[model samples]
Target chain A: MTLDISAIRKEFPILKTSIGKYPLIYFDNGATAQKPQAVIDCINQYYQAENANIHRGVHHLSQLATEKYEAARGVIKSYINAAHDYEVIFTKGTTDGINLVAQSFGKLLQPGDEILISQMEHHSNIVPWQMIAEERGLQLRYIPINERGELDLTTIDELINNNTKIVAITHISNALGTINPIEEIIEKSHKVGAKVLIDAAQSLQHTTVDVQKIDCDFLVFSGHKIFGPTGVGILYGKEDVLNQMPPYQGGGDMIKTVTLEKTTYNNLPHKFEAGTPNIVGGIGLGKAIEWLSQFDLEAIAQYEQELLDYATEKLLKIEGLKIFGTSAKKCATISFLIDNTHPYDVGTLLNQQGIAVRTGHHCTQPIMDFYKIPGTIRASFSFYNTKEEIDLFIGALNKAVMMLK
Target chain B: MTITEKEQGLIDSFSIYDDWMDKYEYIIELGKDLPLISEDQKTDENIIKGCQSTVWLAAEKREDKIIFTADADAIIAKGIIAILIEVMSNESPDTIINAKLDFLKEIGLQEHLSPTRSNGLVAMVKQMKMYALALKMK
Candidate 1:
């Protein structure tokens, strides 16, 4: 099965818009995917017709809004193939989800216990654990990545010992585009009774993510990264695991009873969801997922792989250009640098040509330090992107290099 | 030239290039031609750290006029610094501080000079004024 590239491109209205004199060639999907018209309409309609505070109001709008929001949760639960709908918790984004686990689940760890993360894990995944470790007198360790940006699994035996409490790793490297061997990592970590958290912020849009099949203890992803609205994301944990942890935040909807002295928390998911949620954002995300469910994800992944290969070959032909993250098993993201040129310079010139790409350390400073480079210019592709856009990107990049050099 | 005259000179010079790339070509050349700050001056104290790029600025006053020297690791940032120096360097403390540098917008380079760019140009401009004020007070 093949994806209709043109049809997919048409669904995203922003793709047709121009930036200044040139048409916007968006290659920053790894940062945030452009929204489809369906998702946008869903948000507008929610506010226009069904605006109400959810879970408490006795009004008709509140009941309708609550139904839609919970329905969204069900969609996400099935999307990730979780065991139960109540296991899916809404968050501000991936960063919020990680911090929730670090704060709530960190209570379960004893002093001198260990938390394992990778060198390529985003700062969101690393800093929360570091904070918890520092507060708890726990040891924080890292799994190293080799020259190809693939995790060095040779040391996994020593790393995942009995003291290891949790292994938090990214399913895909946002900077390097390396698809991690997470299934193997999960198996190894669980052998010693350590739970695993998969940062799937970059995976849900590009590949299939199944929580039950992987049997991950916790999985997190942002709604905006998957063509949904911002300010909403999912934290999928096993029902048993989430039940073991305490409620993350305290406020309106997450409680069964509240008193001046003591309070009993609500059930599985609502216990974590505190305060008035982003009601419209959740419904928009549901629409976005429903819109995506029509397409064959496997076919989309295959098409993006071809695009990555084509761009890599063309980019390598340019002299003095070095591509980072050469992992054979990777996504359609590309990070590179030309000679001694700074990424900011190249990125600036590309912007002038209306080619949107990300520059700088990409919030993975440890990975940048590992590569011994300040930063790299990252051009991340999506399913709607094409070879013609890659050609334009290559031309713009050549011009940027010429001007900078 | 007076600061206003210098700004006008830049505006006039940039007006010839209708294309953004051509304007950047001129800016890159100016960046290359910017007077180098002494290696000793490129210390942590002199550095304005931007998330994407770093800029080192040093200044001293001779008579009533202050001379500013700056450099950046990224050429685009350096180019912006060069444009700023062209207007603010060798000017009195009050003139340097009060200068609007509106020529940046007039030349269609305001986006590059925004505080959010985080390339240190914004902080460098403020530091340049601080150096002038300090020298004037002394």
Candidate 2:
């Protein structure tokens, strides 16, 4: 591995914490990753030394805070390799980011225009467009998946007609762990004059993201998923698209000028960043990106792929343990169900052994509904997660399955 | 038998286990011995949707008493429901409706069998009581 897994584990205090008698074997990285000391310390240091409202304040502390906050925006912009800093708008997380686009972009759509999403999208991605559809008299389409949990892009021509105004899809299926062919899909949508919004909440943590390369009109991801603080995220929009879209919220900083008679919205990023932003969260996210930038994500991804492969092989050995997403080119998450076993029982059993695996639809109900299962025991891995942990996870899962069955 | 007495009996039975692992095993054993619902009775209408699993519950009134039968796709959930059924089945509608079921806390199964577990415990309890409520109306 390009990164030292043991040393990396030392950076996260929660990883060493014991749950009951057993040391914590955290396999729920898909839900949220444990934060490293650097990100934690960054937030602490911000609160300790630099606690001030940003932008408007001329005081020394406020200036310092504003500089740090805006600098973090630049870091995020470059992190995603967006063409301009203005393209990156700070958001609550992926949900808020997508909602920003849905709400703002919804205003631009005429009746009869369609918003196409995929079967594998999380509820957050699906519901927003559905809301827009309900409000604007627009049609909502689904890009269905094949038996292997991969999107059937071959059917894209039929799905993405001239009526398609926006194609919103996830870069990686949060529930299925399927790495979607986003670039090809983007090209397909663009051919039909549809703006594509990529939900990178799952993929951003696992792989390298270059928004410029993808050329998706908008991209959204959460900081917490990538070893950063919660309540902070990025919504990267193309400069022209963001400018054309109306402000997502009306509050301080979003406006350039306001009056009893009229109000004018602020430029590019600020128009969307309404009210005081998650100041410490922004600073902490910058630190997280800085810490993560240390390793080649390609290397980390390769290592994680190795771990996914190892865990898959071991998990399949357990009788009646069936994996949900068997897409050939998927990332490092395995959603599985033991024959006639409830995921809750298995997950609770794993928790007893201090192995943390998420047991629910993972906010992707349609995928679960598609699989005809309530939920699956999802064991998601990161680069720091080891083959040894996978072994323990497998062993614990086996025991849980035995008891459950 | 009184509901409190039944609850007390459950608490007394579970008090032997010192840890969660042993407690869960006992629950599983109870689940293994549970009389399952028939295929015909395992209809969509009888199913309680859990986020983690599917639970099927059916209730019939045996004269003045309520008889509940349940099965779960997950073993632990089935075991948990089995415990509920063991204590609650064949009880009077009033007794089933009035039972506090605080024995869950006494047995430390509250965390395991969470009432907020809309998919499992809470939904099971609701379905069981609905059966009682329906029978009481009849």
Candidate 3:
């Protein structure tokens, strides 16, 4: 591998930690990634020297914090290649971003307009649209997936028709690791004059995502999933669309002037940001993205793909083991179930060997229902992971299967 | 044996295995031997939905003692329920309600009993005690 795997693992402090008796082999990057010392130190340094409220204070600390926080927004703008800095709004996480769009931009939809999502969407993406559809008297539809867990785009023309208002889809499936054909989806959605929102919660960490290039109207992702702290995220929208939509929350920072009878909303990003936000989370998210930028994302993507291939090969060797996602394009995640064995039993056994994996429907119950299984044991890898760790995981998985069987 | 005596016996039995895999193997064996609930009793009302697994529990009062039969989709959960049934079944209502079940920790099965694990063991235990309290009132 071109990337030094040993040096990369050293950057994460939790890699050195022991779970019970064994050293931690964290294969749960899909759930949340471990933070590097750089991100951790940046957070600590912020709290130590420059912790203050932003945008409202005129003091020295406030201005410094504001400058840093705004600069962080600029970093995110460039990272996603958004046209304007003000188009990047700070959010709680991906869920919050979707809800913001559903609540605010959703107001523009009339009765009988359709919101098309996918069968592979996480619950966050599904539920918000459902709620908004019910409220606005809009029809909700889903794009189905094939047995390979890839989206079945044959019905795209019928799905994204003239009545379709917005199409919200994940750039990658969190449970199945299917990197979706987002560009194609966006092109089709826009052809029918429908706005598109890309949920990049799983894709942002693994590959490079450019909103401008994709021409998606909106994109959202979480900070913690990208080696940063939790509770902070980004919502990028085209400036014209964001200016057209109403504010999601009405509070101190979101309004330009306040009268009991009538109030005007603030500008683009500030209009959506209402309260005292996660300042530290925002700064840390910026640092996390900066830390990630040091390494070429294309290189990380290649390394992670290699790990996925190696793990998939070793896992398929086990008799009765079936992987859920087998798309030609995939990320470094494998969700599998052994013959007649419950995922929880195998996951628990793997945990005994200190191999951390996610076991459940992964908030994508439709995918599980489509596969006719309750859940699958998912092992997701990162760049820091090595082939040796994959060997250990394979050994542990074999023992788990043997014991369960 | 009384509940406490049965717990001590289980702890003694588990003490024989020094390795983690050995301990899990024994649990798997116990899972194979779990006192399964009747197929008719495996209804919606009896199902406890944990985040990771599904558990079905049935409790009946037989001659002033509570008889518990439980099943879980997951083998580890089934094994844990087997341990619980071994200790808590065929015990007096007052005894079943008051049992602390500390031996689970001593046997390293305590992690399964955690509310986070939610394999339905905790909920099943609480439901068992609730049945006991209801039967006593009756």
Candidate 4:
């Protein structure tokens, strides 16, 4: 089924806003996607109607809330094709999920065991591994990226030796928009008996992620980035893998039984999930995934590719605009710099023109270092965004560039 | 001019430009006119780490007057720091210490800046006050 851009845009209230005198042209989807009214209403409906804590209370409201929360787990499990709902653990966000793995699964690693990551990973992916490596006395290895910003996979054989315990990588580069060949990485890593965690923070919104098909041992994504509420994300671990792992945090709802002397953790997913959980946030994420699942993702992807191609062609025609991450397979994100212009200045000028773009190292300082620049002006898109918006962005960016120069 | 008068003058100058383009141009010109910091003064210690831009600020006390110089990697940020230095520099330690940046609000600057740049503005002000507070104790 073909999509209606205007109709879809109408679903988001914030899209109607203006920056100064100009209409808002939001291109910072990489930072966060604008929440659709469906997601917002789901959150509102939770607080307004289904307001109760899950998993503990004997009240009717608590039972309804528990049903809704677990139903969300079922939706997410199907969305990713997880073997069981127990494999999907609710988290604060992608960063929280990564830390959970680094700590819980991390406790299992031994000295001389290595963890492999790519240079394009966000700080969330890098710093946690470093912390755990130091604590566990494990070695850390990096899969270098080529000049095109794609991961150089020729040396995967060298990096994924038998000693490699876990190989963590982003499914798509947040900074460079490089869509990694994770299926290959999973295959190679598995052959050497290594568990792989996919940071799908940038990829989940753009395309479908089938965890079962890919057979990744672990996967992480942010709900907010996928048009859900903030403070909630999903951490999918293989059932067997999670059973072997220890709990990341200690709190209510995560215990089977507790005493002053000892505590036994809860089973499966709840074992990793602690505290009250982001009750409302979980409901919101479920609604978002439900709303998105209705559409043919292939249709949405094709339309988005058109926007990407159109924006790329138009942006390239502008003088002094050099786009980074010229990878053949990428999403609708373009990180670029004007000749001798600071990205901060470019972003500022664009803001005055009512165009919102992200400016900085995008939590990928190593990518910036690779490009030999301080930072880049990143313009990313979602399916609801139109070619018209991209055209306006092109015009505004051109005007901003001319003025800055 | 007194720091207050200098600040008022800046506000009045900014009010002349009806267009944001012209206002930013004026700010850029002001940045160009700032008493630039020397290369040696642009050390890592002097750098005010901003998420959007890198700002380097230098301050010294001659008698009771505080002399300040600053630079930024981004022109817009440089212009912003120029406005701060124009008012706070060459004022007494007591005045600098108690200085209110009401001028930024008055000229619609603080609210106009992106979150990152506004945070950098706060950092610049904080560093200047810290310098004044240290010298006042000495």
Q: By descending lDDT, how would the candidates be arranged? A: 3, 1, 4, 2
lDDT of 2: 0.88
- Which residue ranges in model 2 land beyond 4 Å of their true spot? B32-51, B58-67, B89-99, B113-119, B126-138
Chain A TM-score of each candidate structure, as shown: 0.99, 0.99, 0.99, 0.99
Give the Å shift of residue A190 in candidate 1.
Answer: 0.9
Task: Give residue A302's error in model 1 in angstroms.
Answer: 0.3
For residues A366-404, write the lDDT of model 2, one tens digit per residue: 887888877878989988899999888878877877776
The DockQ for candidate 4, computed on C-alphas, is 0.69
Candidate 1, residue A19: CA error in Å?
A: 1.8
Per-residue lDDT for A1-405 in model 4, tens only? 999889999999999999889999989999899999999998989999998999989999999999999999999999999999899999999999999999989999999999999999999999999999999899999999998899998888999999998999999899889899999999999999999999999988889999999999999999999999999999999999999998889999899999999999999888987789999999899999999888889988899889889998998999888999999999888999889688888888889899999998899999888878988999999998888889888888887777777
Q: Per-prediction DockQ scores?
A: 0.82, 0.62, 0.82, 0.69
Give per-residue CA lDDT, model 3, range A4-54, as digits (tens). 879989999999988789878999999999999999999999999999999
- Write one digit per residue (lDDT tens) for candidate 3, span B1-138: 888899999999999998999998898889888889999999988876553688888888888988889888888888888888899889999998999999989999777777877456787788888888988776
**Per-model TM-score on C-alpha atoms:** 0.98, 0.92, 0.98, 0.98
Instruction: Write down the DockQ of candidate 2.
Output: 0.62
| lDDT (Cα, tens digit) per residue for candidate 2, span B18-131 | 987788999889998777888899999998855357788888888899888878777778888898998899899988888778888888876655656544687777778888
Better of 3 and 4 by DockQ: 3
Q: How far off is model 3, as Cα RMSD?
A: 1.3
User: Any residue pairs clashing in model 4, and if so which?
Assistant: none
Residue B111 CA displacement from its true place in model 3, Å: 2.3
